[model samples]
Target: MMQNTALMPGSRWKDPAFWMLAPATLFILLVFVYPFVDGLILSFRPMNGGGALANYITFFTDPHLWKTIGTTMSLALPATLINVGIAVPLAYRLRHKTRYQKIATTIMTIPLTLGTVLIAQGMLSYFGPNGWFSQLVQALHLYDGPVRLTHNYWGVLISLVISGFPFVFLLVLSYITGIDPGLPRAAATLGANPYRQFRHIIFPLLLPGLAMSFCLSFVQAFSVFPSAVLLGSPAGPTRVISIAAYEAAFENYDYSMASAIAMIMGVVQLGVVVVVLGARRLAYRGPVTGGKG
Candidate 1:
């Protein structure tokens, strides 16, 4: 048998593959790791000169600060669920080549190009009390009173849905398309109906991708700032954790407190991600065959 020199302890460092990872490792260190470590350290140095945990104590003690976590989760979870729920069926239907596939994809993806601020401004113009939506509702006599959609919780929720759907849809669409079409076709041939084929053959394979999509969408919705400020009552019902961190950093000029709050925000996001990924482990992990299994 030939000896594997590349596996040798001292010779591994001379491998080209090891050098190929240098740029990415350096980039990650500079872009993600360094900032996170620095912020974590900064969070300990409270401006008021208390213990290392002073900022965390203040955050937990104050209702105004701690309540933002619940508020953010309320918005993030529902928005993520709606996006993923809708995207699954839609992506399934659009997995195969169709006449309207490109057109539909282009229309759906248009929202991704629009910024959060622009979407918020548009909602205010179109969904405001006296705007087109309310006017149309009144014209059609859908409701007796003014249709209040903007500057409230509903407005923020709508913004999140509109912006987040495209992302989830695209991710799910890719995952669905990557599945072996013959698997579903084989199920169909074996007397399985459409719903049965989907549930038994397709969904198990797609669960991992869906979990990842949900985590990403939840993170995007959780960190919402401009929409809450522009379209919702930031001081009251729609106040998210990001707003609290912003106030601590900019308004109160408490970098340490802001860093602490950011850390908390990261922790909550990480918890949700961990739960989702853990659940994904129970899903199917078979090979993704290209119809040749």
Candidate 2:
């Protein structure tokens, strides 16, 4: 049995296992947690003079903020759902099945390296009205004019799904692979058909990973910028909160207000993660294991 860790002054702080976490803890403190607290504190203060809740009031009371959230959800919800839905099946297919799964996964991850801006540019080149696709469509008389996929919500959604699917796929695959192969075999031996086996035996074990993928994919799509700015009219239909914050901070030089928006974003994503994990707890249908398979 493990010793009572709470009694010692430096049991956890000085232990090798705990020390191993120091770098990560320091990194989070310096990069994420520290900046987050700073931004939260800054959000409450006014830029000109007053110390009232003006900055937060401006953000919370704005109809534009609510509208932007709707737009963000319009894109984020569908994109995350599509990404996770497609990824889970792909992940399941690759788990302990294909020898080239790693290579396929690497290829799928190529879009991640391209960055949002580059992908937007590439889509512009490939899917723009006057671009190659437009030329082909015109030559074939597919439509009266160029198919406008860019500079819209569809463009942003497409970019997010393309970029995010691989991340979800990989995350789900890691979890899927962790499932004990014997569980499925046992189900099969008990005369469970493939579909029943998957429904009963395989799906439950993947819930934790599904929750994780949903949270990450949602967060990624929620904070989307280059895709919205480059591929869509961010100030128009695709106006997301991140764009609003960017405009406030850099374009308008409203750092305090920008900080408020930033704080809202962090809180919103945190809430989403918590909600998703809670939903997973409600929906999970997996066998418990004491250790790694």
Candidate 3:
């Protein structure tokens, strides 16, 4: 046993005389090791040479920082809920019907290819003061003033909803497809109604997946930057945490504070993940009867 243990340690990291370990070992260290080391150093360094704890302190004390955090969550949570609300029925229909699920999925998925920056730019042409929607409103004589959808909270919210729907839809749809179609059928055979079968069986099974989707969608909305900057007032109305981080890093040349804010954002995202997982656990334990999920 002693000899075997001695040989195992020597051979574990040894070069393959027979030929296999070098590439995989190098790949892991390169991908995970270097970046982690760099990020840790970057997170602590100040914007300038002398470190006075200015950046981190500034973020913690600023009311704007909290407001941005609130704005991010306000958009993220509601958008995630809305996406989930629409996704459940759509996912169900996709699996059972399959009439044009691919087409519908593709339509919803188009926004993902066009990034937030591109979408923001396009929105200006379609929804801005001199844009088509504005002209339509003017033709209808709806209001004397220009419609304010392009440069406000609504624009940012709309951009997020457009970009984030497919993410929730596809995740839920994949989960729904994996569900045994026969299970719902079995419940129906035993005299369970459609809604009751879904409530008692299908929905419980989906809590974990839906919870995961919510976290992902929430993170996506919360991290919005290009759309908020281009389509809304980052300094005035829709300044999200990500925008604040970018400004810190680039505009003010405050890398340390930017990293600090980023770390804070990471904490919030992690907290959200934990909260969702906890809620899912609690939800799954309940009587799978009738709840909004």
- Model 1, range 67-145, lDDT digits (tens) per residue? 9999999999999999999999999999887867677789987898887888998999999998999999999999877
Q: In model 1, which range of ten residues has the least summed lDDT?
A: 284-293
Model 2 alpha-carbon drift over 4 Å, by segment = 1-19, 49-51, 138-141, 285-292
lDDT for 215 in candidate 1 is 96
Which pairs of residues collide in model 3?
A: none
User: For every model shown, what is its TM-score relative to the native structure?
Assistant: 0.94, 0.90, 0.84
State the lDDT of candidate 2 residue by residue for 1-293, as single tens digits. Answer: 87787677777766887778889999999999898888888888879756658887787789887567778878988999999899888788888867689787889778878877888889999988888888888889878888888999888889888888888888888888898888889889989998887787778777777788899889998988889999999779999989989989999898998898888877888888999999888885544543237
Better by lDDT, candidate 3 or 1: 1
Candidates' lDDT values, in order?
0.92, 0.84, 0.80
Question: In model 2, how many backbone clashes occur?
Answer: 1
